[model samples]
Target: MIRRQREIDTPHISWPDKLAYSLPALSLAIIGIPVYVFLPKFYTDTIGLSMSTIGILLMAVRLFDAVTDPVIGYLSDRSAGRFGRRKPYIASGSVGLAISIIFLFKPPVLSGAMINIYFGFWLFALFFFWTLVAIPYESLGPEMTGDYHERTALFSMRDGFLIIGTLLAAGFPMLIDGIMNIMGKVATQRELFSFMAFIFAPLIVIFSFYCIYRIKEKYQQTGSDDLVKGFSAVLKNRPFLILISGYTISAVGSNLPATLILYYVEYVLKAQRAEGFLLIYFLTGIVFLPLWIVVSRKVGKKRAWIISMLINTGAFSGVFFLGPGDAMIYGVLVFFSGIGFGAGLALPSSIQADVIDYDQVLTGQRREGRYIGLWSIAKKLSAALGVGIGLVLLAKAGYQPNAEQPGSAVFMLRVLYALVPCICNILSIVIISFYPISEQAHAQIQREIGRL
Candidate 1:
């Protein structure tokens, strides 16, 4: 019976399936730029909104995000159709995300309270649909294959594509430059984002359909499908909470450097070389992803993640000393940071998959959506909080866009950009150390769940 159950839990996933599954993540990575890195800068530098106002607006957006993820997750878990439980959300949400990007990138001209209102409204719409598409899509990963290491292989492909997409997004300005040159004109940030939206619209549609048509959810939710029970089970699951907390804090650490990289390059380093630096950073991640996957396979995800955090903490600690005209030095540090970046990207979700399996063992139901949704909430909050903290801190330090900031401001930027993330990384290592779900432990949980 145990052997049969083990056989039932594990499914073979072909390479074609892995490639197809990875395509949607490319779209996700492209769209992520405006949300994670560019939007704050664009709104502040171009639209003339104060940094604090933008920070508050972002916090508000993420606060709204906090509410929607679990609600969507719950609905997704309860949802069923000819396509599958997860695919319907993926399709509809992708469409919604595409439309929202269009409006977000090209809002009608407004000023004063109206600009903030406009930004907040579209950001809310953008985040809502993003949650819709992302949560269900993430939930599908663990269900694709139950093999412990194979999950890392799948995400390696996913994040590899994600890095490629980010690189493309970064190059949009240059892409705009080439196109405008061909047409005998100039380029702008708004135009770059507009072009990106146009490109991503079709890509999102194509990939969403491809995944819906190709990838099928392998595990069916068994026993009671009660929503209340599902929520209770997830809430009561200690390991799941530990994993989310660790991932969330690590996300905050990850986001700070991202949120500040553009500023770091422009003001602190005083160079028009931010995009080049970002390319190196993401490209390094692409190169190191397979290595991190191998490390995870060898040492297990939790330990591998701790090692990644240590490496990143060391890298960020080095950044505390860099000043103007230190772009090359920063580039070397970013390369090491990207190694940690690669591990953080691939391992956490795979670890979450394992944690979800433990939840199955405890609750006798498959609740990947709820768990992923909650994880999404934490992820979003971390990004929002990172922005809020950075902007608020900088505002207090008298940060002004496109102008020479005071010495105190420069010090604040450098500290927030480097030190805060180091602290967060240290905290993440501590939190992750408590993660009890080892590969052997997950295998035992799978065995127990399979027996039921």
Candidate 2:
């Protein structure tokens, strides 16, 4: 029987390796903004679908996509060939992703009702291919290194580029608009979106291909081949249960602030530069990310993550009281909140690798894909809940678009954007405090697995 590659004393992953592995995130993120932020408006305003119809379609497709995560994860875990389990899925999926992205962005001329059918079909395709690439891609991370602290650096690099890609994605529409202005022509929403999809289409494939070319998977197929049994194995992972519970709840809270930031800034703060403030928050996160890796090494991933959550929670707490003429203060708070942002993403992922190790000791198998699948489900579900729950409440509280919101609506916005997320983080901290693994525990886990 083949044994897994030695991860305990592995050398530091070179920068080149990290960069190559991280390239897909950059491409995926660039396209993600267009899909996430621009797609609904494009269909509603450009394609002539009503907001209600688009919302329903989006939610349905997303739910379907979430449900598919486990199946793909199980399939990826079961795949065995010379190309390896994750790469084949990623490589093949990027092709489908690229094609669907093109068609989705550049919808064909069609009859009125057919347009909606066309939209839903392509949206479903896009998400399916996205899951195919994303689940396997993320699954590879935990297996990349066994060194506890090094895992932080690894995921930090990945998430650092994720932040950078988000910033670039947010700015690209303006970049296109700027160039159009120089040409004495303004780009329409459709044109702007078409350019984005076109540029990122080949880019997604190129990045995935590059990653496949450079990085190698260290495969050990000791896991169960049966899907139901495989998932049953996952359900019993206590560390993962606690970690996912905490992360999902925190994500629900975190996502609330993200979905409502525009509403809060426009209605409650009555301030401008919402985009500028967002840029500051993400830029600060990317710039200070490496510092968190160091902090994780010094203090340990668990403690580092808790500290990051605390910083973010404290910074957001003051937002509920802010109103007009408080953009500067809000900016300061956003910046402080961002200081922990990279750590918030990177450290948990590193700690998640530890949890997977804990799982391996219990089941005597490596099932990164299933773990990541569950993580993805939590993330996507939380995102849907975050946006949907807050909007429903805001509507009930008397929110009206493009008008002065009522006092009750403003209060609800504050609670969702500020107080709710802070409470979630505090609860997350408490939950994560119960996680039993550490560097020493992980090392012992490796030893135990080796003996098996």
Candidate 3:
């Protein structure tokens, strides 16, 4: 039997401290969901870019962005400073994110050739800044606590708050639009951008800074000349590699539906009122968030994750069998799928913390930043692929946004929306089943590390 770590000696951390520390990282998700879900729609619809062009642009930029994550992760692992290596990057990245977000939505007054240039700049800046904030922020969770169950609880808090962020990102655009329509005020695209910036950007900045100030790092940096060795060590961790691969694939499965749901509702369901339907979808997930967390704790993360994947796969697969005018039927499917997504959202990070412990036991160094950076890269890559896949399918099906979609186009849209994600998620279930870490195994690993 593997001797467990002595629990008595571990310093007790308050729940408030954990919440404060985790909140800033959670805010990044708020910013991220919008960037992923809305930005493509914004460019394709509002900015007048062709779907193919937007897809190619997003794929190219995100590939570039994905490649940079490991390098940033490696550098962050070696960094030591007064505010800490992670915090400096977090602060700098937040500023960059704020500026990039503004520029992404608020382009120049010029149109035609100049507009593409503005768009290109916005794309590059947004991807770059998002990396800086996201990589370091994700690294914080595993480093915050060593207790296996405590780590799960910490992630539960982070993910619970993250659901709120997801809801806000998913819901706010519709809410704003509805509010404007109610007041009999017609807000232009530019005005909507300005309004979102005015309302949320400040919250992003304020909460991010407060999170930085509140969360204290337990791991003090060791000054070592063997930084290259540290990078090599992190790369050699096999468990991390497996987890990242599974995570990337699963992320793609999850994001594909989200990226295309609006299009599906509008084009296939023939519903112009997509926002309400989407709100219902997101609300179901939000309501089930706590339930999923509780379920994860009880059944163990891997099993919980697999269960969610199965639910999502089943829900998505059901879409292919539904025809037009089945909006309410589809809506019911979405609500069930959202429960699966809630589990998907909550458990993975907890499992990630478990992986971090496994790495620490073997490597004798905490390289959470590097691990998280790579994980973020995989997720971003998956998202980029999802958008690209959606675009390619749209093009193949001859989808025309402002015009009537052909029967072939509508049929193809349903297949991509339902069948593709269903297949991907089925595969994800297989991948997650291979995830070796469990709650008991993780606790044992932490115990071993404590002895060392």
Candidate 4:
């Protein structure tokens, strides 16, 4: 037993190495915010595409992206070459990502239909390469460390950098626009998107190359040899199922607030501007990540995560009662709300790494890419579902964009923004309560794997 345990031990990764390894997350966040948050608006308002066409195009492409994740995951697991399993895809995908971003944001003059076609093709290409980069990249975390707490710490760095990336991505364009306003000049959204794409393209290249060269993949000699049986076994892993489901439910809760924040500030609070409060919300997540890490260390990851969810659930509940001119009160609520946000961002992926470890033992093979791929699918589906549900509710309540909505519409918007997420969080907390992999169970699983 001792000898078997010794056979699987991995070296401790230093803080600098973890940070360097996580730089790609920064670029990932930088790219993601623009695509999800801003691109639809850009296409509709700037490129002359109708909202309906843009909406359908986005839905089709994202569903296609979700479908392709597992295939990519299976291929990534089976891949072997001089560049190693993860890096070749990471390096090549970075290039594809850069080219696609440039073309998508900097298109030539085209009619609405032509623009939709253009966006669709490039968006598909972008998601394809994004899958290439993200799946294997995320798979590398658990492989970097064998210690459970270190996995949490590692992803804390990851989620921290992701928040920083989000802040930078969100802040830069707004900063640019603010500067233009002060100078009494107007810059179109196209130019802003073009500028961002140009700047981040090279940064993505630099970070991807840095990660590929600097962050070493721990060598694994055995992988699942049969694709059909392996994929089936992965689906059957009970912990993975629970983790993905709870995480998906949690993602819906997280996404609703994001999708509705502007509307909430604009209508419910009657605030002419609330970007400062939004920044406070995101910045708090980065700041509180270390504290959450400490909490996870003391209470265990699952418990810590539940506590965070409860905090968010309780904090968001107050927003349902807020009214016009409640901006200051809302800001305070967002500040407290962000503590949970930080923990939500950091803990789940680390917990996921632990589950991957459990799977490695059960199957006697490493299938991190496959697992992370399915996880990615859950996230995409949740975001899609959340947005769809929120919009349908708003539409049913007679909400109209840029027009004064009736009392019923405003009340419905508040409910969707505040109460719906609270309910999702409660449901997630309930689902996760049944998760069975405690620290002792994980250690036993490791011992069992070592014996194999």
Candidate 5:
């Protein structure tokens, strides 16, 4: 019988290793923005579907995601490919994602029953491909480095570039319009999607392939194990369970403000150019992202996370008190909120990677796939829940898309935008406080595992 090798006190990863290993994560982050930020709006506005209908469709598709993520994770964990367990899936998933993204954006001219068919097929393909890409890519973080601080640094770089992708995704439509104006052509939403799909599809394929080529995995298994047992062992890991639970709830908090931003800008503030305001909101967070990394390094990840959450809570709370003409005040608040948003966006994965290390120390097996799978599941579930909440509240408030809004609807929008996220964010801080792994504790665990 071949026993798993005990950990050796390996030297810290050199800068070259960090850069090489981080590429896959950076690629995923860039590709992920389109799915998270634009897809909902695409279905509702561009595809001419009702918000509630799109919400239900997304919810059903995510139910399927809940099933697939863990299974994929388990399979990847137990895989013993010649290239490595993750590389095969990573490469295949990237290709699938590129194809699906093109299909998603460029719908054929179909009417009546064919329209429904198009929607269903496209939705299925999108979620299927996303799971394939996201689960394996997230698994790489924990597998790349066992050090706690180093994980934070790795995730910081990944998320920093993620913000770049988000900014491009957010800003691309406007940027394309400017270019089209110069070329004496009009740019519609369809035209914008076409342009982005054409540009980004090849980039996703190439960057993902580059990442697969550049990164190397150290973990390898030659023996097979029961999939059921592998999953059960993962479930029994307490630290991972706690972290996932907290993160799922925290995801709701993170998504609420973003989901409500357009409504707040258009209905409450009466801004015709609401996307510009949204861009400002996103850019504010991007600018503050590096500062959060520095602070996390100085004060430690958990405390830094808590501080960021409080700042966000305070900023979100300010919206509740705003009157109709408070756009400037709201803008200022959004800037402050981004300070907290940057922390929330960047730190959780690093913390999750730490928990994975704890599990490896206890079980003598590297189960990054299982942990990443659960993490993906938690994030998707929370996003689904957040969208569900947004739809429910919109319905309750009698919000009709593209209709002249009523005072009551606008009032309710403000309250939901401010009160719900503030309360949820405060709760998230409390939950994160209960997370037991300090940076110091994680470093000591790495040392202990090295001596094992």
Candidate 6:
């Protein structure tokens, strides 16, 4: 790895700087669960919006991100100031995100038309600032330290916190309502989210600022702002294309189970709920992250990643055959599948940073933001595809909510939830297996950049 003249010879990131970089991921992740899992229900049940209307608005807003994400990445790359390029966006966007959380979570009392208007406006604002903060914030990771193994450790810790934050957010509504009842007070969804707004808003701002104040951007950025040429070059980078494709495919696979877990448990496993399965899966991921990091160090990141994918997809594929009375079996399978979950999250991100380095080596430029933005698009696209396909297929199978599902619907549910993800994971593995940057290759890329 290259070192600046006045810089120390060490390539290791300090614990303080690593924590500063990783903690914001926790706060950012807190926003995801509430918005994705609870927000629609809140609007539909409490705020008087129809399910169809809420779905359209939510999907439209996400599609809107297709435009905003890359543009922000493009702008942030070109942005220059005393605080450096990414910091300006991170700091300012943090405030915007906080405000949007407040308004979006705590909607004002309104009638039919006014409610839709209020909902759409603030939802738009939230995602707008989310892209604003997320693109630049994620771009900072690759530049923090160029060491390959340390990069794994860094992202592992970051994603570990992300899972933790997600778990925390999952319980917020229930926790608040429970506490209210314990105190002999009634609670409403609006009031619950209002309390969450106060909690989450301050957290995002505090952590965003804390990270900005603590970490200094180390790698000197040298990149062009020409949108056409920059993106054209990004498209031409073969390794990046391969990595992003593989990641997107796997994300689509994983999203299936997340989208259909409830249906599968209720129908196939004859279960009342799936909160236990969800907990086992995510908790295992959080607890086992470091093991994958260690594995990556021993057997290179690429092989370790492929191994993790195999562990994940391989274990989960067995769920396709389980019938009613298989809850314990399902739990064991979920635990095995989750063993690779942390590696699945952290390794791709670490590999992405390396691919960006390869991009720099090719173009003599630092264009991490553009790559991050495109990667974000890949994720969004995968999610949209996953949800659309899973739900639509099941609906076609004659799904009726809260009723005994037809055999066709149950079959479709099992196929979509279990088999489809394995196939996607396998496809992802095939593509990612072809990625070119081994640890040695990335180190050489960094050395080449230093020569320039």
Model 5 clash count equals 0
Q: How far in Å is the alpha carbon of 51 misplaced in model 5?
A: 7.3
Clashes of 6: 0
The C-alpha local distance difference test score for the whole of candidate 1 amounts to: 0.82
lDDT of 2: 0.87
Assess the local accuracy of residue 20 in candidate 6 as a C-alpha lDDT between 0 and 100. 88
Q: Which 10 consecutive positions of candidate 1 have the poorest summed lDDT?
A: 1-10
Cα RMSD of all models vs. native, in order, equals 3.6, 1.4, 4.1, 2.7, 3.0, 2.0
| TM-score (C-alpha) between model 5 and the true structure | 0.89
- Residue-by-residue lDDT tens digits, candidate 1, 295-337: 9889998999899899989998999899888888988998898
For residues 93-207, what per-residue lDDT tens digits would candidate 3 score against the true structure? 7787788788877766666767777877878887777677767777876776676566666776677677677777766777888999999987777777777666656666777
Instruction: Using TM-score, give the best candidate's number.
Output: 2
Query: lDDT by residue for model 4 over 21-49, one digit each (tens)?
Result: 88999999999888888888888778888
Which one wins by TM-score: 1 or 6?
6
Of 4 and 6, which scores higher on lDDT?
6
Candidate lDDT scores, in order, read 0.82, 0.87, 0.73, 0.83, 0.74, 0.88
* Ranking of candidates on lDDT, top first: 6, 2, 4, 1, 5, 3
Please give the RMSD of candidate 5 to the true structure: 3.0
Number of clashes in model 3? 1
Q: What RMSD does model 2 have?
A: 1.4
Residue 365's lDDT in candidate 3:
65
**TM-score (all chains, Cα) for each model:** 0.88, 0.97, 0.86, 0.94, 0.89, 0.97
- In model 6, which regions exceed 4 Å deviation? 1-10, 219-221
Compared with the true structure, the alpha-carbon lDDT of candidate 6 equals 0.88
Given candidate 3, what's the lDDT at residue 414?
A: 83
For candidate 5, give the lDDT of residue 405: 83
Query: Which is better, 2 or 6, measured by TM-score?
Result: 2
Work out how many backbone clashes candidate 1 has. Answer: 0
